[model samples]
Target chain A: MLFLRDFGPTEVGGFGISSANDLLLVEDIELVHQACSAVHVTFHDESVADYFDRQVDAGHTPAQCGRIWLHTHPGNCPLPSSTDEDTFARVFGKTDWALMFILARDGATYARIRANTGPGVQQELSVVVDYRAPFAASSESDWEKEYLANVHDAALNTKDTTVKDRDKSRSDRFDEWDESDFCDPLLQTQLRGY
Target chain B: MKVLVINNDGGGFADYMDVEPNTTVATLFGQVTKSSRAEDYLIRVNRQPCAADQILQDGDRISFTPTKIEGAAS
Candidate 1:
């Protein structure tokens, strides 16, 4: 079961997560290479490249291949766009499974879970806020209230129907592939599909 | 020299270690596989494909992502 929570303070970013069995927790959000407009958010692969390196250095494994894509909707509709689905399909789809979490300024929320285990698999589930078992954190403080008060209201009247993709070779040094030397002997055979 | 190492094997393992100044990627990888010859790992340095003989830098970031499937949770 894919699960997540509200990230009210995030402007627009992404993160690699650490999960405990069925539960998902934000190890930390990587606030890098974010191209944010009222309609959508785009994350440059560089934004997450080092974060992944750091995450692995800390002893985390890929078995927690689970991911949570956090973004906000500019309008009242909290559903994902076709491009969003495609993004999930191409990037996160490589993993066995992952989740996407969407938030709207109007308080509308949406979520989708995708898996590549056996066949075509993807679904949009209800974003039920569990006020009963509230998040273990401090309540909104006065400064937080003032900050939230000044936030723009549903800034996007229209949604972006276009697709925003990251750079081609995230593994590129300085954003360029090193094809000059013998990088790997089995490179061609292994990366045939990718 | 110091290099950052990341492996997305099971859960995953990221760490920093010292290596010879001119150590090649394959040489370092050889150390990582415990001297066993496993070739299915996707090796990248600073987000770029590196040759087996690619020399190490003082602060290069290296990562290894296994091609094996993680399947579903139990």
Candidate 2:
């Protein structure tokens, strides 16, 4: 009964998550740990990076596509930090139709589910209601398909402008870094998509 | 259901065995902290945020985490 919303990073990776039908979706423990391991250090495998890219590309239409990003705190802190906020602001500033999820080692997770409305001036992130509730079952309903189509088209239409602008800025920032410093090797591969 | 309580601060740990369903989150906190305050720790159910008054169900995964960490946003 896990329904996942998919989104792409145009230049980065794809992200999304399972939604609760009546409560919160408890992610598979092993999957959380795996995601944590992938993001813990600097670089991730190129294949993983490509997987995300393909998701984003596929979600180019605008029906009701969802994007999910996964990360973990080394210890047990689950609250987002200044850096996390900054990154989210930069990455989601343009599209503003994505969601974010954070998993902590101590089994604490947080979700920011975006609300689509208005001229995209305001965004709302809701905390999961019940962590133990089963996720909503996926449906191939016409409404669902139509919603997905809208999101896909919206993504494609703004592909050049929004995503390109963000990626360019991200690359500029990357160029300022010192390659020799102790960088997380995983990050190198993850950044390849961007 | 048995729920494991792990507090990240100073390695504080506790366990609630055979907890009944329909237990309020606030009541669970009271059970976890017998004497001190429960307001200090940030409680999460299976990783998502929840209010103290929210009800707990079967097979719930709960953890008590701290407010701060080194090299993390405070």
Candidate 3:
């Protein structure tokens, strides 16, 4: 999934699925359908609900499927953008724990985990690829198909890649961020026509 | 009555606590989340969605998790 960012002009995202016993050990990175731009990505609301349903059907708890959110940046900065920060605060704030992981095209990375049980705690985490763990064989074709199905790149007209425009665009182009429908699991169920 | 409180907000923790008899989920939610709105969270009892007025029982497990989380770039 990390390699797919190189194939497009937009950012990509996926959930890091882990077992209940080892919540930090990502067993799989599951990509869902989303719209993407050079600097923005939003998962389809129904897609997220469906993903949770599928995970539950497979015997994984919702916490296991939902705690770790992983994404890629098309630029060199792996630091959380203002929008990313807001998203993390508003969305993951209430979870018992949630992790945000970012990978930039230049190979820089960022990760943070937050726990909310008592006094809230937030900590930065180091990223490493653990190759020693036994892994399943990967199929390039399947990954390509997954990428093609999920990542719909909307052309970004602006040439400015600086932090100024990124901050400015948060208010101008991100009206959707204000809406709870896209992020609310209850609304997600309603949107799925359940 | 002792109940398991699995707060999934900041610094997520699960612990057993004593509550007054007949304490409703709404009452416990108010105590746990403080100023936060209940509508913003998915409150559960024994792993199922619960009504705010549902009375707490001894050994009941309660959890409060945010129902919405967004990912964005700016």
- Name the candidate that leads on lDDT: 3
**Best of the two (1, 3) by TM-score:** 3
The C-alpha stretches of model 2 lying farther than 4 A from their native spots are A1-14, A17-49, A56-66, A114-194, B1-74
Scored against the true structure, residue B32 in model 1 reaches a CA lDDT of: 70
CAPRI tier of model 2: incorrect
lDDT (Cα, tens digit) per residue for candidate 3, span A1-194: 56677766678888898866778889888887676777788775546655654565576665777788888887788888887888687777667788999988888889999987788899999988778767899777787777777666444332223223344566586554457657888766765789
Task: Go through the candidates in order and give each one's DockQ.
Answer: 0.08, 0.03, 0.23
How would you order the candidates by TM-score, starting with the best?
A: 3, 1, 2
TM-score of chain A of each: 0.56, 0.38, 0.77
Q: What is the lDDT for B36 in model 2?
A: 53
Please give the distance, in angstroms, between residue A37's alpha carbon in candidate 1 and its true position after superposition: 1.2
lDDT of each: 0.53, 0.41, 0.73
Candidate 3 residue A168 Cα shift, in angstroms, is 32
The parts of candidate 3 lying over 4 Å away from their true place are A155-194, B1-70
**Of the native A-B interface contacts, what share survives in model 1?**
0.13
Report the C-alpha lDDT of model 2 over A1-194, residue by residue, as the tens digit. Answer: 11112222111122333332311242321111011111231112222223322332443211122234444554466666675565454433323344555655556666665533455543345555564555455444643332232222123233223333444656776663567532756666565645
Deviation (Å) of A1 in candidate 3: 2.9
Residue-by-residue lDDT tens digits, candidate 1, A108-182: 767777766787588877765445542445444542342232222123222221111111123443322447433
Docking verdict class for candidate 1: incorrect
Q: State the TM-score, rounded to 2 decimals, of chain A in model 1.
A: 0.56
